[model samples]
Target chain A: MIKSNSTNSNIQQIKVAVDCIIFGFNDNKLELLLIKKKENPEKGKWSLIGGFVGFDEDLDEAANRILSDLSGLQDIYMEQIKTFGKVDRCSFDRIISSTYSAMILKSRYTEDKISKYNAQWFPITEVPDLIFDHNDMVDIAIKRMRRRVRNFPIAFNLLPPKFTLPQLQVLYEGILDEELDKRNFRRKVAQMKYLVRLDEKDMSESRRGAFLYRFDETLFENEQNFNL
Target chain B: MIKSNSTNSNIQQIKVAVDCIIFGFNDNKLELLLIKKKENPEKGKWSLIGGFVGFDEDLDEAANRILSDLSGLQDIYMEQIKTFGKVDRCSFDRIISSTYSAMILKSRYTEDKISKYNAQWFPITEVPDLIFDHNDMVDIAIKRMRRRVRNFPIAFNLLPPKFTLPQLQVLYEGILDEELDKRNFRRKVAQMKYLVRLDEKDMSESRRGAFLYRFDETLFENEQNFNL
Candidate 1:
């Protein structure tokens, strides 16, 4: 959408805001970071972490600022989902929001930090009714995330640095919201040479301990594996 | 992005605008509609058809209004490409514009109507340096269009109601910017049951004439063929 010219006498100046649907994965389920509104209008209701874009700020910078302030994390993998411009989206005013979907490591957000801001990670499937159009933002983000994981290794952003293949598969299954064949899933990962096996194992899941793996950044950057 | 609260005395309101990259396919090549800027900061230079969003207007409504005002056509296939929010993207002010890419049938734009608005079509590969961040917008839109054409039958929006297999292939090659094996291309298209072969033929390309085909909306809506 275009900006109204300063000379236009009748044009209205609408408020611009940014909302982020932060996704996390833990315990074989996808999680969403939601906070109880602390201000009036929709105060005390679940809502996506958001803030207004400063006059001199870039939309991305605003998104990052709000994200870091809320979750105490930096350099997370985020993508612009789409802009939501419904007139009545914000009951208090005419606010146009540029929404984004960010994948963050669930462990990065400490319990104390979350509690301080009244933020909590709810399972994607059981998220409470969010304020205004925040729920629609989450729904679109998950759908986009599901498609994104199949083509790119972006979902790895949600996994721990060292994770077993089963853990990896569980994350994929959770995002896809479907049961993937174990053999097929393994074969798919094996074909992606960017995944390097590590010496350590994750013993929490099995006594024998499934071997741990980490994404090889250098190889992933160089590989022509888009069809994966 | 978030809405700046009324109490934020230090916050500044930024300018917002919408720009559209109108796309068409004809003469075995992809085309983009561009207009000569009528007002400063860069008057007379080629620029995408754009306008500012009114205070209370929805973004989609603003997009449609600008498109129809310029092309005298409605119901165009348009999607939000991305929002360009760099501080220096616009020379005059901090205009954060949401860019959209639209697909239009070549026949829909008449020469007289185009000339009235000083709008003209340029080959996608030959588009001149556009105003502000429009070049970047077109570049990104083309990349996205390539991927979109592969998964969805959206490129058909650029074609007429009836088209030959060769014509369809030409449009695909134009968008993909690659030559496909005739046998392979035809085979892939034949497998899509949503394409209904018409008894009529298109004689423009060849004297013998090639049979025409039209997309079956009902079948296409029901089919699960995403690979085509």
Candidate 2:
């Protein structure tokens, strides 16, 4: 082993924090949850909902605590994508932020809870300049979500229980940031056994109405591989 | 914004460290580089090469520093896969370890440098019990490498500059942990435009020598996906 010249006492202890990029799908568009900072060091600027790591809590626990505190939701689909630890990334302190990408159904969150926390969902295309390295975090999260949605059925987390085929296609288009062919998209969706077609129809968009489908969680658990 | 009850001064700061799972390929088998701990706290046990994050450097810089310190090689393919921050993951201190997965060509490093740090390459199947959560880190790195190898030409980082088709097949098999059909694998290789065949042949393995090939980095950059 290489002889160590530094000990634990000499090494600097830095503050560790977790930031969440909560993504939602509504109005056939992808959105991100952001809060306006209330304190100094870039106050009033938009930022991802975040908090410092508690002494007794694990990193994932801290993330869950923060997410649940803001949205009043539990067991959200979340994953830690990357950790940002540049020396000057934070203006006030040399803190390391573990960034998590999460998806939650917009309808699942109560409007009162969101307003109480001063949080609002901004469409991904219209996301304004964020504080510190937050803009970079959002970009990374979106790229990860795009890659993940192709292989896994996690995109259902952002949609309601039952949704139209057009709604599903629009959600994929929003996440992929490209227009897909209608026939080819439907052909691919037709092969997925986990997406079950229901007798119900959604008449919100057109008079003819589109058939509603719900992602079967049990079947997805057994079949695996969304492969969209 | 949520009211901040925890200030930076009151929060318990923890030690942040980076551990590297350095993988290499030799004799058609995947191997890991490990060093025996020489000091107290699980001394004399095999562990991943790691060091504490310096006050002045970024996380990636710290990972590169530790990796180069042992292997005497720079610019190796490396990426941060995950951060392990369980409350009791470390026996001695409350340490938050940011684990990175790295790959290096075994032929590039001299044996003298490896022995100077008491490091040895252990086959993936033969890795001994590691201290703390190092074993779990190795498992996660392998899964990530498998997923990445299918989509990227990063597996070239483990092979020699000039290699045979059989050698490449064996390397892929080792990474994917499965035997692929020869005809199917060859057909897939034929579709990759960036694997340039050379005039040389490697005769060490068979009476009928196989032709050598090298990866075209420029073509790969333009083509983007390996899609193996």
Q: Which digits, one per residue and each the tens of the lDDT, describe model 2 over residues A75-107?
A: 886799899989778765677889888776677
**Could you give candidate 2's per-residue lDDT for residues B1-228 as a string of tens digits?**
222223433344677889989987666678899988888877899999888887678888998998788656568767899998887787666778899887766766676878777688999999999999999999999978886776567888677799998988888888776888888789778866899999989999898899999999999766542210
Q: What DockQ was computed for model 1? A: 0.28
Each candidate's lDDT (Cα)? 0.79, 0.80
Cα lDDT for residue A224, model 1? 37
Per-prediction DockQ = 0.28, 0.28
TM-score of chain A of each: 0.81, 0.79
Candidates' chain B TM-scores in the order shown: 0.82, 0.81
Model 2: residues >4 Å from true position, as ranges?
A1-12, A157-167, A183-228, B1-11, B159-165, B186-228
True contacts kept of 1: 0.32
Q: Interface RMSD in Å per candidate, to 1 decimal?
A: 5.4, 7.3
Error of 1 at A180 (Å): 2.8
Give candidate 1 misplaced runs (Cα > 4 Å): A1-11, A157-168, A181-228, B1-11, B159-165, B182-228
